[model samples]
Target: MRQRVQIEGRQLEVSNLDKVLFPEVGFTKAQVIDYYVRIAPVLLPHVAQRPVTFTRWPSGVDGQAFFEKNSARHAPEWVRSVTVPSPGSSRGRETLDMVLLSAVPDLAWSANLAALEVHVPQWQVDGAGVAQLPDLLVLDLDPGPGTGVVECAEVAHRLRDQLVADGLDPVVKTSGSKGLQVYAPIECADREHPSRYAKALAQELTRQTPEEVVWRMEKALRPGKVLVDWSQNNTAKTTVAPYSLRARPLATVSTPLRWAEVDALRGGADPESVRFRTDDVLTRVAEHGDLFDVADRTRAVLPAV
Candidate 1:
């Protein structure tokens, strides 16, 4: 049976199929409740009006649409989405979708999500015309157990600087878990192009941070450091769908964090040490633009490789 539960006044539907998908991830409902309580404040503002869904699959939550839909609503003027064929082979598999949120609009504070839904009749997917998508692109910087938040933040700061130097605008947000996310806006292009641009940016960022960050594309080489994955930029790749409950059994989510909280974690604080409600960081961003503006200062040294 599918059950609908409310968190922070938002309603979510969870299906029994979700439990069947992950029997080993083991997390109690109480733990999942705690996780939601912790992440809601920081993540809500970025995706308040967007419709989101959670997938209880064994692999992970499907976050592409969550990001796409929300980015469309908050920053549509600058971002867009591209639809592609679903990659799964099973009969009746859901159609695969991808989006691009652009940040190149000339207008000030006008970046909103621009979306494109591809019709996959053969796959039973319906197309929605250019509409609002989400504005957040998260690079979950998961460093191993021994790596602290400071080390991760230092690397995140460096990565943001590298992206800005490449002529891309990036913002830093704490993952509210063990790592950080360096989000950049995709401006003035369709979905396909932004994915390409994001991939280029990810690759270049990893190349510049060989000591602290490891590009996950090379699995054999990523033994002990942070994984700077470019695959997420691929149209087919999916992330933790925003607002979706993670299969962490306890329902931990991919929530956002405040800069101060991020700094606290960097200083050896626990991941749960700080909690933010939705839009709290966005409010801060509104007051002080782009947390990762150092990118503007170091542009000459790190030209897009």
Candidate 2:
């Protein structure tokens, strides 16, 4: 059975099944509720009006089990599952409830699915379409386990400033996990091209912060600090499906944040540290709409590339 948990005036339904899922990842019911409250707004726009499937599992299921189920299924277009893998596993297992599934528009879906395959190989795609992916791309800056929020925000700010200097409008958002996602739109005829653009942008960020961040493409030599993943740009790479539930211990929803909050959170404030009862963040997004100024950025960067 599912019960309603209210966060910041938003209502979300949590299933009895979630009790099993939560403990496996070290989250309590209230924390789970808090996560949804904070992230739902960010995810809503990407998943708006789309049909999705929720993948669930019992608490004791191991990572291998989680991986097999997802790899074996023919999920709907809009459905993806999140997983909570066991710690210390070299090959990350697909823990249940770690991914989100959605039926994105054909163009965006095709592009995103292609991207997903590149970034995460465990996922499977069941359908195809001729739609093009969005030119707005994101380069996720993931701070490793021990890093703090201040460092994350500083890197994000620097990256954004660099984009602006380069004549692109870059926007920032919280991953609702451990890091920040910097997004910028590009002018591309199809999804394949955006990955290359995103990679170039990531290279620039890494060059600026060689001490703090390492791009994932150089995997064997990863510095074990933060990772600047350009793979999200790959036409076959997939990000947390917008609105797809994450396998966070508290089941945090990967949501978007405003620029001011992004700035504030960088200085020790928690960007993903939000509650369902807080209207402050949602109010800010309502005022700002989406973060990337696509038209301006595209015009500036496309010609140079």
Candidate 3:
């Protein structure tokens, strides 16, 4: 089923509203559209200047999913887009035409297409359509087998303290999957500063606590440890955008957190406590407002390790 809706004066045709996107909770495509629209006030600011790469799961969470970096050729003219260089494209294409979801209508369009996850790079495109240097640094803490969100949270606290010592203010968020991602705003002159800073800190943490932290990406080396994935800072890599839905069984969101919440997780709070569903997140926004808006405006230069 398709229905024409007008949002911010932009009309869109949303389809298959009744189709289930999260099978475990029976969350439907219509609910997904509603979540995106209602969350737009806070979400759009974070998404505005960034190029979005959508993870579409037309067949629901348990079914097949595919990543789409290039916006569809048939996309509406009103849908904003930007072309960015893709040196690692397997298709041998020099660039990708990515969607820039700046408004509620753009999000509704993506949700209609079953885009369950929204991913964006640390850097954003400038007014001239040029990809700028990264304005933020990220450390993706992923727990391996025999580990979970609690372990990741513990590691996040360690990382956060170190970031504070270095004079940068870092924030925490759930990956909306099996980990926590810590991000800090940084004013860097070039592309390599963020990645280099993250690698140094990850290595430092690994050295200080070899029993709990691992910086490498190799799966075999990660058992019983939280991998501080510094590689997501790469220009080619994209992290799941804050507040984007995960393609999980329960439709968890990549929700931002107050450090107090991370502290609770470290103090043995239930892992399920961090897993927020669509409705839960809406309530959270209503209560707390955007916890991550500071990261977008605050900036500090990387300090030598």
Best candidate according to lDDT: 3
| Residue 301, model 2: Cα distance from true site in angstroms | 5.8
Model 1 ranges with Cα > 4 A deviation? 1-53, 57-84, 88-137, 144-149, 164-177, 188-190, 267-305
lDDT of 1 by residue, 240-278 (tens): 433324334233434344456556665778755433332
Task: lDDT winner between 1 and 3, please give it.
Answer: 3
Instruction: Report residue 71 deviation for candidate 1 (angstroms).
Output: 22
RMSD of 3: 1.3
Measured on C-alpha atoms, candidate 2 has an lDDT of 0.48
* Per-model tally of clashing residue pairs: 41, 32, 0
Sorted by TM-score, highest first, which candidate order results? 3, 2, 1
**Candidate 3: tens digits of C-alpha lDDT, residues 159-191:** 999889888888888999989999998888688
Better TM-score candidate (1, 2): 2
TM-score of each: 0.51, 0.58, 0.97
What are the Cα lDDT values of the candidates? 0.42, 0.48, 0.89
Cα lDDT for residue 175, candidate 2: 62
Q: How many backbone clashes does candidate 3 have?
A: 0
